[model samples]
Target: MGRRTLVAVARPDGRYDCRIAHWGVGADPIAQSRPLGTGLTASAARTVIDATYDQLVVLDGAVRTYVVCWLDPTLSDLDDVVLARTADPDAFRRWWVERKDEACRALDSDGCDPATVRRALLTSLRNRASSVHCLDDASFLRGDR
Candidate 1:
């Protein structure tokens, strides 16, 4: 099974380079506005993140925004979120690769797979979130889509 967690990297300093994106609640946890490596830098990342809030469009309050806040690396020895709800974030990436592989298995099929199209849809989302929400599901791999 694949697990999805809000991913982040630590700088030499105390601040973190966290990816800011929205993970929808209920049904499908994977929603629009997924991260596309924008938070790799602490300096310019914030400016880019602020743009998300400005561009946000709420459809009758159906969509909510959340940031992936990793557990502090300094407080613990673990490099990543030690007590993540599911598997490591890297596992999530691996799952995407596997899914794409399966989808491309058919010789008759052409164009992009679900994962590829998803990565392409990555966009800026509202940033400066105060907390993290944990809601992960691997249903898509079970042919849920």
Candidate 2:
């Protein structure tokens, strides 16, 4: 994370407010909350943020993970945040896998076909959203996501 970055907040009117602000005090030179845009839809806000900032975070209720655009290709496996953050890694892993499998089974019951599943799986393996939406869509096909 940088000293200053762009952050967005959803408003009561179902729009977004984006700004370039620092997390520090005393009016830093980096940037101020100048209202990058107002009355913007979520998608338009995302587009503005993508064009203006290198990273973004979801700060609706809690401090969530920031954007991860690039990673060292030499790493063997990316750590699952649940496993990495939990006190009991083994227990959390079991529970996470079970819940994931259950969700996949439910999706399978929802009439998702095989070819679509394969395509979704491939897409997720390539690049995925933080919430793992594509992987969720394809997890039922091969019993994994």
Candidate 3:
């Protein structure tokens, strides 16, 4: 599969959370696909996403318009007021990954899958953020349309 242009979000640990952006199939996480070579560490994929964003759209404007704020792992309130106005993929990654890790730890099962936990987290967050475009992934992040 060829590596297509995508809206990639940065994780606090420097890993990118990449996804598809078109066909109305938004919010589809592509990290597991491994077709785009997105598994490469921070700098490699960062350059890819950065270049894509910088060249395709105004980098600063895109960042400002499409914001993905990762709420606290322990947060029960998913209000928009609690969300950040600016883009912060690093913070989102930190909170999201940490929450998934924490949930997996609490499972205490023999075969607890972290990916499953992450999906659950995404579902829950998506439910709470149905009104606004959270831009948590390329699929969800759209301003150019």
Candidate 4:
């Protein structure tokens, strides 16, 4: 099996962050915290992060929900790996759905908004298509008398 890279998104203290790790023989997981950036709401950040990861795991803590996005790059996009909702998918979905309007509003606020970010994210997802092509070969040919 090839090396796999993993990315995680977690909210430790009411703030959104992301981490990345490599999965393979003797591979060490590299985790890091990501900034939600300015003008991005928690819901918007979650949505963006969710779209990047293959699986999400949610955990309940003292006063907040932890959203984790896990990815295996050997079978997925290395740069596109994500750790989105690591606790509750239902809650994350609801939060993202409700915040769509707010994200749009934010986009219109200062000529830039979360919707723009969302759209960019969508585009990135759409652009990551992979295709396979095969060429003619003579491996199937046998000697004829």
Candidate 5:
């Protein structure tokens, strides 16, 4: 690690706060925060802090990995961790087009049917959010937005 990043912190009074750590600096520029819990012991607060930090890391990793795939030809393997972040079908299909040959090869090696998996992934993304009320369907597909 280059510098410490604290996503969620354990407070002495038995609650946790989630904040974004400024790299190499102590101040955190937080978007929002809420108390993790109340009436917790020191060890329990520590456990909550650790778990919340891990979750934040995974969420951020997935987001960046997906964005990179959209912007460039991937040099790294786009594993399940990255793929899970692409919750929009149009965006994901675009990603699929960029690496079709590679993806197909992988699918074949795993003995999975490409057509079936493609449909499944599309359905899953569709089920994730209400694009009609939440945001424009096109915006989700457009990575630059």
Candidate 6:
């Protein structure tokens, strides 16, 4: 099987506070966003790091944009996950679906909607409490990288 993928979405507030749109599990604690700031908040960053998932997706409300991040275990550490600026809702929707499908297959589960899977992924990531074991964001983005 392939590597499982998880995604989380956050609305822009000049800070990263993403919501779990679809997680591959039950919805209890839900998903929350963490801000990227100074190192003084190492403890807080630790909390976020402790809650790290395989992949995270943030949406900027003001700019109405989306950004993605992921931890590739294959790489030995978490790398920045970024998405190009897109205004087309359909394009984003399609992209979400494709990735969600691949993720489901990797996890050996039935494929679900973008929102459902997104929420589930977020939940799964929280439960794991570690960066994704092995993920390649570039490959996921290009569909062939």
| Candidate 1 wrong stretches, greater than 4 Å | 1-87, 103-108, 111-116, 119-145
Specify the highest-TM-score model's number.
2
Q: What is the number of backbone collisions in each predicted candidate, taken in the order shown?
A: 0, 0, 0, 14, 0, 18
- The lDDT of each candidate is 0.30, 0.39, 0.37, 0.32, 0.33, 0.33
- TM-score for each prediction? 0.21, 0.38, 0.29, 0.24, 0.22, 0.24
User: After superposing candidate 4, which stretches have Cα over 4 Å from the reference?
Assistant: 1-81, 113-145
**lDDT tens per residue, model 1, 58-140:** 11113222322223212232222111122233443344345434444532265545444333322111121222222233221
lDDT per residue for candidate 6 within 115-141, as digits (tens), equals 554456554444432222223222222
lDDT string for model 5 (1-145, tens) is: 2222234343455343434333322222243333344454434423332211211211121221121121112223222212223334345445544554455555667776655555454454445423211111212222223
lDDT, model 2? 0.39
Error of 2 at 19 (Å): 0.9
In the range 1-145, model 3's lDDT, one tens digit per residue, is 2222344555555455554443212223343223444444444533344312211111212342222333323334343112222244344435544665666565555455545554566565455432233323333223335
lDDT rank, highest first?
2, 3, 6, 5, 4, 1
Clashing pairs in 3: none
Q: What tens digits encode model 4's per-residue C-alpha lDDT throughout 1-145?
A: 2222222233445443433322221212222222234333345444443323333222222212222222221223333332232234445534443444454555566566444555553443334322111112111011011
| lDDT for model 6 | 0.33
- Candidate 5, pairs of clashing residues: none
* Tens digit of per-residue lDDT, candidate 2, span 3-63: 3445565567766666665542122312445566777776665444321232343334433
